[model samples]
Target chain A: MSSPFSSLHVVDLSGSIAGNYCSRLFLDFGAQVTLAEPENGASVRHVPPFDKDRRSLAFHHLNTGKRVVDLPKSKAELADLVAGADVAIVPQGFKDEIAKLAGDRCVCVEVSAFGADGPYAGWQANEMVHQALSGMMSNNGEPGREPLYGVGNRASYAGGVAAYITAMVGLFTREDDGQGQKASVDVAETAAAMCFPYVLQYFYNGTNRRRGDQDIPAGQVLCEGTWVCIWIYPHRFAAMCKALGLSQLIDDPRFAQVADRVKNWAEMFDIIQDHVRDEDAEDVVSRLQEAQVISACAYRPSELLENPHLAARQYWDGPDAQGLPRLGAPFRLSRMPRSRVNEVTE
Target chain B: MLPFENIRVVELTTAWAGPMAGRILAHFGADVTHIESPTRTNTWRTNKGAPSPVNYPDFDPGERRWDRVFLFNSQNVNKRSLAIDLKAEGGVETVRDLVLQSDVLICNFRPGMLRRLALDYESLSKHKPEIIVAEMPAFGLEGPHSSYAALGPTMEMAAGMSAAIAYHDGKPTVTGPSYLDPIGGFNAAAAIATALYHRRKTGLGQHIEVSQVEAAMQFIGPEILHAAVEGKDTKPDGNRVAHAAPHNAFPAQGEDEWVVIAAQTDAQWQALCAEMGQAELAGDPRFADVGSRKANEDALERIIADWTGAFDKHELAAKLQSAGVIAAPVNTPHDLAHSDYLRARGFYAEITHPVAGTHPHPGLPFHLERAPGDYRRSAPAFGADNAHLLGEVLGFDSERIDAMVRSRTIADAPNKEA
Candidate 1:
């Protein structure tokens, strides 16, 4: 199972969530990872939900399975680690600190609140700033209403991960050039704009993307309790009519034909919502799934973690130190390719 | 193999962030597997994959057609499935063995579940020093509310998305689900690739953890940084901008039918005023500067709407755009798929799902050079590749695999309820 480029070493110098996750990816794929810690140990260890030993469960879960280098008060040890470092995950672009350490050899992938050279460069920011500035909140809830953020710290993670990948691109490029270069990535609140849909509409049309309708032309503006950010396409569209016991929709003028339906999609959406309201969330979803129409529950974290398919998929274990047990890679490799589980000797 | 193609990744993750991280590696051609148990299927029932209950019956295998919609099929292509009973002893070792032999191990467990299974960072490192482990949750691995439960909405709200919408002028609005999951995907992919790059340099594996809430917040930097720097609230401008005039989504003849128009320059504004047959309006002082126009958007919108009321949204959008005014129809998913530009860009690809039949879904957002990017196969069934993976990757004997399966350690189906 060894890869031809299996000789890489990745050192993760991060505190809590974002940067560490970036490094763990390298660690998982057969790369050597060195988890460095400050003299006080990981700040995450003191956060909360301590184990019986009073150690942070969340910290333990994210920081396990790696050797730790306690930074000296002299700050020289940090320099040594950076000198040997290939990629450094600095969410806020600690350029000066990283520059002194990673120096010439290392590539610094700095994740910033805005961008490196923006009007808001030196401004202090976190997840909240990023989400709001991206204009995503504009279309999130009822039209002409206040904006809402995501259910999770999705922006920080998004910036962190996007920054990490950008670092990889630098790495890939370095491979061809046989030279390493430092890259500054600005993962601001605008970073996730592409995923919001219709960038062209925004760029060319001056469209405000943050509005949601309870029942609009194409879909419903859903508010299903806690899992707030989810917009749903009902399962009973004419295409899925056969699956929803409403096969008659396939022949109905308004409901029949993808083309015709597209023309009257707004009215169609409202009509679909009328039927959807009659059914409970689960029933509507299950029925729609059966019919093969695109329908989703627009779930929240708890609902997602509690899914039977996730259970059936064995995707989670239990709540770990971080929050809840989660799924990793989504596939299975060969287990009979002479695999052996190595246990470090006591 | 060039890198991780020969490497096996055991993904014990659900939802989008974590699973998608592994899915990307799979796309790069890794043997990524998913773990499942009967009780673990409750996460994102509507958003993830499932059977279409209306057309397909739940109990009847014939009626139990698989849920292969955009979200599921988009991420899960080219992966294998395995059902595991993590509570069982042999099941624990099975994961450990899988980790030992795997090139990468990805999981999105909240914060602490790895230790209970003895597969935490410390545990796995003992088994395989160079193993990559990734973790993502509602928040980061640390914080006051790190352990709290939330989906994309809650996270977005926590990140201040509600505060930013400011459209209604007072109450906060939440951005909800729009880009939360996909943002996680993009960031997770970045993190995973960075780790891989680091490993390529160090030969050492590390633990990577991400907080979805934090990740999503980064996108709203304008407000965040502005508030931080200016100590002022960035109010919502509706569809308008701080520096532009006549910017907004104007209503059309139909409900949910609208056109977004931005006249950034004087010439653009002149063209718009001409289109309205009110060429004299552009000369008015009240609508001269962007500031003047901002103060008079209501009357301006009324004027624009009156002009727009007669034409099709798409037709008008095209006409305005052709005039060099930034404009396009605000599209729905169906409209998006059928769009001429998107079609020309090859934004959609049709493929046959093992259970869901032939359909199109949004393909890769990021592309690589010299890469043949296509959905190689539909998502694998539960334990669909158990024997094949066990035999081909782990080199297990048939008797051993059969015994393990019989023992209910590594199952092709749910070995036990969570």
Candidate 2:
């Protein structure tokens, strides 16, 4: 099958992880993405999670399927490359420069920390800072304790996804008018969008929503030494009780409705904990799932590669130069399978 | 003109993921129609089949509770709603007719439900040979766990995100909101757009599948690769990055308030030290370089925390940012809703809905110079466009529409028992 982006070329001029990720999506769908690396290297190359040889695993994962070229030293040389490309992914600082170089024929997407024009524009922020400012960290961790910022570069990754979607929208607009346009993706705003429900909760209630407030039978519980995450809403309460061999609670007036469930959550959780205490994680999960309850064993990173479901789906992509298995395409297009090339051509 | 001005999308999705995909297209000018079953309404309308304070407006589930849900209204803006019983007679035919006019169809049903309803790609392609179908299953269509039911938290656990994002001493933890749902939504929208582009070029339609779990693993791809190469999992380190020291959230003056300070470069480190009134520490051997500071991060963090604890979080963040240091207050939802920066960027739009009243809604993350998207309309009331859709778009006469409504094939409200 022909790839969706087979005829397109993308030049990635943003030296951050977000830009690489945006271009990576293009390459995955079969566009010819060329990473225009600086004289030293893209900044992400120096970021960590390195292999034994001190090579950046993050950089490898983000750039495996793309071509790499040293950034041009002169404007004329850079213009030559931009003129041939269908899209350019650049940092916000270089938005105008790239737009001028590519003219009105190449779609340009600018990735930034707080957008090109905002009160916080040009402010310095890493992933953690982005999380803090975006309200993501504040929503995580225990309520009274210091908030936790999740691992990895989530804010920047979200920015990349937004950029990819925006770039496609730009391409569609260009198809109509025959003139490419510029778009901007702010990591902070993208991160904020992910916190939609919680933000709305505040708007609706006029209260700051905090973490660690699980309703009855809706939080993590221990089962045979493995923590299994379960989310049982009010309607599923009776079914969960019946499935977990606590049917006696199904008839208990104390656990009848939403308010009562919240008031007696601790007592109900203790009963659930005692019931699942000796059961194996898999057994407990299967039983709850059989009742149509949402549940899963919290898996470690290594265990996911060996997950029976993922294995059956053949979701892992490769054992590239470093002999490491990587994640496959985020989404599959039946008529356009993703490219699986594992080497970068300079 | 808007990017997707003439495009039409039919969405048969219940929860966050599918509705989100349709919402994105709708924002870009696609005329998206969200189809809900009268007997099995979107779960977001209620808290999984029961009224909950969190999902309602001002904690009130009004007379038409399903239409007044905050969760549903937040994502369903710019789209019309149609409540129909696909299991009822003439229902399948009605949807097939709508599919004939739609450029795209998106759903997040369990893998086989579409095929069971005769709405799967193979079935729909026969009617509208150029229809783009996108499905988001928790797992893939043919996997061992293909039929397994999953919510956002369970998918996060299966995707390895929970394990990668915990405190040093805590077990795997899910985020406050299920982060995986929106991620799945974004990926699915991107996939549909790509397929639409492909069809425009090659005159072909395709089925796109997004395994929500697999799509989520992309965010932590480097960690997965690390596990593969090193044969060991990277332990969860709370609020720290390998490339920087003093990259932790420190407590601020207010109770439970905190500020994040990330001194990634030497210049930033010097600025932080000067801001803390300890410029000499920047020259100390144990804090001079990134490696040294990392090795002594505990002591460095302690020193920084002592200084930060005396100031208000917002003020501290502003003070640090002014000194060329990377810093921000750990913001609560209230902080975000009232952010000057967000206000300046026009990130939130004041959208007024018929049932839920007017409120500020978040805008799209990206902005195009010429074709910037907007909230063209508020979320539809229950089946607000049912008559319009059937009468105009489907070309069904009022008599036939009334007959279908009498038979419960078409509904303007959810079944009371349901």
Candidate 3:
């Protein structure tokens, strides 16, 4: 059966990862987000992870619960749609035109790469470009090298979050005045600016913050070809060590104090890696959890789904008829909020 | 601007997350009273030590005013800061009274801690029926690992991004970006807004509980789905494009500068190749198809990079754009602050700070043509509107205000991190 979100009278005029990403949130929540195509479809149509049919993976991921309207909705039609919409989520550039078209009927929220007004507003950007621009890349990755780019568009995701929230605020504000209002969200590099606190310390704490190296894994041990990281951060290290048959290490001088161990992490890691490299990830993961350590089994995307924790949560709603898997909402209520739209009759 | 101009929002939060929700309201012209602890300076002041997140090493070799460059000022524009420690005597009731007259309550402490402080949903609902109470937790309010310790890195790793964000040839990396925190901040704001919409329809406020894990996990949807189905191995590809060829950042003319160029159709590639006077290369069998081009990316990258290396990034960007190729320079903070295009579009706005001088700061991301005016307030002083909050919201008398100040329960002044 088709999902509910495809039924709403929605219009999505977003490009790259940011605006499209944000609109997808509402789509998954049951908003009928129609990919409002102008001359060409969304820009990410060119981006990869494209389907077997050669459709952009970026497009597939974000537009899963939405429909694509090949023709652009006319201004009058756009206004008519918004007149009845509970919320209108638009990216920043189209805000002025959308608000003018919709007048006061729709609650308008716009998303942009940087802030609405500033010297850098019109700079061209996508995912990696914005990451560096946002000051996030500076704090990520390793030392003595170019800052590594994050997989998936972090800045874009941040912008999506910004857009989703801004629309909601407009939704609420519409209540007091009994009229819909306009709210523009500064997304892109501007929104991603606040994504790191430690990065801010580089500016604040007089410390130079750069990406760390592949050689020195933060708190992990180098073993063979892989880096074996121990599950003993400052907060819950003692408990994790107990399950590893290494409880004595909690009191051992080499690993005695959290501060000391942090200071001499490289050497300490060598000792730890020697012990745990041969141990299975499942065994190590289970033992650490049994000892009450807040630990996780770090794996690639494929292994993550098999994780015991996610399975217990039943996080997926199961793959739809299209053969793509689906995830649940990020926020949950006991009553459970229904997806705003229902299955399309067509 | 100031979309909620007349609406009053009461914020019971500290540090980052909850205050962010309040900031969003304030930015759009909501009258937000930030409830703080009288005795403790805003914990966010620690970042007060820097210039901006983009500026790497703030070494004041000489004493020149750098600026109050931190996250707090940007997140806290146009809001009222009022101090009232809930841990102190009568602090809980003081907040309760404010809630009665307010539209929303935002707090980002640990799950049960808010309840322990007597500032939970049940208590606030008593004061106002339609009062929306938003609770921001590091983890969810329930679950086995509910009461866990966390920060940005922890959350980034927890959400399956740490392993997913590795370099193509190297180990997994952590960007140190608070992967889901601000998203959590944004989600809290959105949830509060949606609930308020429901409340408007039904006249009932809601209890919004947002978890950082869920926020982080939201981004990991493809992976989660993949695991849910075929259970495949999805690792880092660095900057590689799985389905497209010649999609990588090529070095541009400045220190550590680069430009990303990607194209799919043969026409776009023909256009790019023609622009570079390398149309002959596009017809080569090795790069004939998108798949073949992606497969031979290293060789293709060399050809593209060599061409890009000669032209100035902007000129190359313009040339590539004219050719229907997707391209943009990897902008640094300096480039962002000073770009002419940003200035022309009026995307950045300048706000005079209490201490810092007029430095061009970023502003609202979206603009409405119907009412394109100013959003109210600038980055305010800590508890700058203490009197307004206490007297107006709680109906505190002059004597009571002075008594609270004397008792160190409230303060109109900041600790002066400057």
* The candidate that achieves the highest lDDT relative to the unseen native structure: 2
How do the residues B319-386 of candidate 2 rate in per-residue lDDT, one tens digit apiece?
89999999999898889889998888788888888888888887778788988998889989878888
Chain A TM-score values, per prediction: 0.69, 0.90, 0.80
Interface RMSD of each: 12.9, 1.7, 4.6
Ranking by lDDT, best first? Answer: 2, 3, 1
Against the unseen true structure, what C-alpha lDDT does each candidate score? 0.53, 0.84, 0.61
Q: Which segments of candidate 1 are over 4 A away from where they belong?
A: A1-140, A143-170, A173-346, B1-7, B42-62, B65-70, B403-418
The CAPRI quality class of candidate 3 comes to acceptable
A222, model 3: CA deviation in Å? 9.3
Give the alpha carbon lDDT tens digit for every residue of B1-418 in model 1. 2234565788887766666777667766677887665345524223234433322212222322223323444467778876667766667677677778886777676667776777776778776777877777665655434454455544555455554453535334444344556666566666566556556666767676666654554444323433432334455544555545776666666655556676766787888887777889989988886778888978877888788867886778667755666554545433444545434434456656566555554544323232223566766655677787677766889998888777776664432222
Report the Cα lDDT for candidate 1.
0.53
lDDT at position B278, candidate 2? 97
Worst 10 residues of 2 chain A by lDDT: A209-218
Residue B52 alpha-carbon offset, candidate 2, angstroms? 4.9
Once all C-alphas are superposed, what RMSD does model 1 give against the true structure?
14.8
